[model samples]
Target: NIIQNVLSPFKPLPDVVHRITAFAGSGKTHTLRLLASAYPSLKILYLTFNRDDDPLASEKDNKGFPSNVVRQTTCSIARKETQAMGNFEEPRKKVVRDFLERRLGHSLNYKVVDVVLGTANAWMMSSDPELSEEHVRKGEVCELKPEFRALDFVKLAKALYDAMIDPHCHEISMTHSTYLKKFVLSGAEITCKSGGPFDAILLDEAQDVNMVTLQMLLAQPG
Candidate 1:
C-alpha cells in the first residue's frame, strides 16, 4: 500500500524527519494515515494544541480515527514521543524508563503543557519547561493539533477572493489575523493563539482560513 511505501525506509532511518504542508483538499491526512499504517510498530505520534474551553488535557476522544489507531488532538503526545528520542540526563531517562516500564499512569504515560504564541522574538520561552530550546533542540518535534482554530465559511470565501483579487494586500500578508478580525466585525468569531513548534502539520480545508487565522496557524510549529 502507499503507506507501506512511505514508511519502507523508516526502520533504518528512524532519526529521519519530515514535514508535510499542503493546500486545501490535498489528501494530507490520507498521506499521514499511509505513513502510520506503514510504520505500525514505530509508535506513531499525533498532536493537537490547547484551547480555551479545554485548557490542558492531553487525552481526548478520537471519534475521527481512520482505523483502530487513535487520532491525537494535542501536541502533548508528539512532544513526549520526540522527547523519548532524546538523550536526556541518565536520571531523567531512568525516570522515563521506570514510568514506561512500570506501567505508570496506567500506561497512558501522558503529560500536558501550556500553549504559547508570537514571533520568535514574541515568545517568552520560560513558560513551559517542555517548550524550551533544550527539549526542541534534542529532537523534540510536535505535530499540529487536529482542531481547527477558525471556521467561518463566508469569511474564508472572502479571504480566497481577496487573495485572488489582490495578492499583495494586507490580507494576503496578514491572512488569518486580518481576515479573522473582519469575520468578527461581520458578526463571526474564531479562536487562536500565536506561536508553536510542531513536527508535521496537516491543515484540512486550508482554503477556508483567512489571514488572522493563517497567522495563528502558521505561528505553530509543524
Candidate 2:
C-alpha cells in the first residue's frame, strides 16, 4: 500500500526535484525495487556506485531490472556516453611518464606516475569545472612523501590533468576519468546516448553520490 500510494503517477513539477533519504534498512532500496515493479514501462536509468563489473555491459542479464530499465555505474555510463572504449592503459601510462620526464628534466618513476594520474583523477571528480592546483590542495590526493609534497607535484599534477583533456592529443586514448572530466568540462549531457534520454533516473544511493557524479546524473535533460 505504501509503495502504491507513494508512487502514484503525477504531473511533473518544473521547479521541484524530489530526494528520498532514510537510514539503512528503512526501505530505501526496497522502494526502488517496488517502483521498478510498479512502473514496468517507465524508461529508467538506474545509476549505481562504481563496481568492478557492470551487469549491463554484457548481454547476459539486466540485473533483474525490467527491459525498459538500464543499469550502470556512473563511470561506466560516463565512458559509454563519451564513446570511449578500449584498453589504452600502456599508452596513457607512457604518456604520463614521458610528460613528467620532459617536465622534470629527468626520468620519472611509477610512484610519480601514479601520483600524477591519481591527482588528475581527483581533479576530474571534483566539483570545480576549471583545472587548477587548487584540486591538489583539496586533500583529495594520496599520502605523498615529503619529497613529492616539496617537489611541486601540485603544479605538475594540474599540468598532467590539462594534457589528458587537451584536444590536440588525439592519437592516445583517453582514460575513463578523462572522458568523465571532459564530459563535465564541455557541458555534455549524461543521457542514454544509444537510446536518447531516459524517462527517469533512479539513483540507488543518492546520499553517497559525489558532486561530479551528481552533476553527470543530473545533466540528462529528460
Q: Per-prediction count of colliding residue pairs?
A: 26, 0
- Candidate 2 ranges with C-alpha deviation above 4 Å: 8-16, 25-27, 52-64, 85-98, 104-119, 138-155, 162-176, 192-195
Query: Best candidate, TM-score-wise?
Result: 2
Writing each residue's lDDT as its tens digit, candidate 1 over 76-116 gives 23223222222211123233333333432332122211111
Question: Model 1, 195: alpha-carbon shift in Å?
Answer: 28
The lDDT leader among the candidates is: 2
**Cα RMSD to native, each candidate?**
23.4, 5.1
lDDT for each residue of candidate 2 in 1-222, tens digit (9 for 90 to 100): 865777775322333356777898797766766677676766766777654346345534346666777777777766655666556342367767887888889776677677666666677777677656665543423455445555566678777766655667564456656667667767776566565666777787777677777777666575
- lDDT (Cα) of model 2: 0.65
TM-score of each: 0.29, 0.66
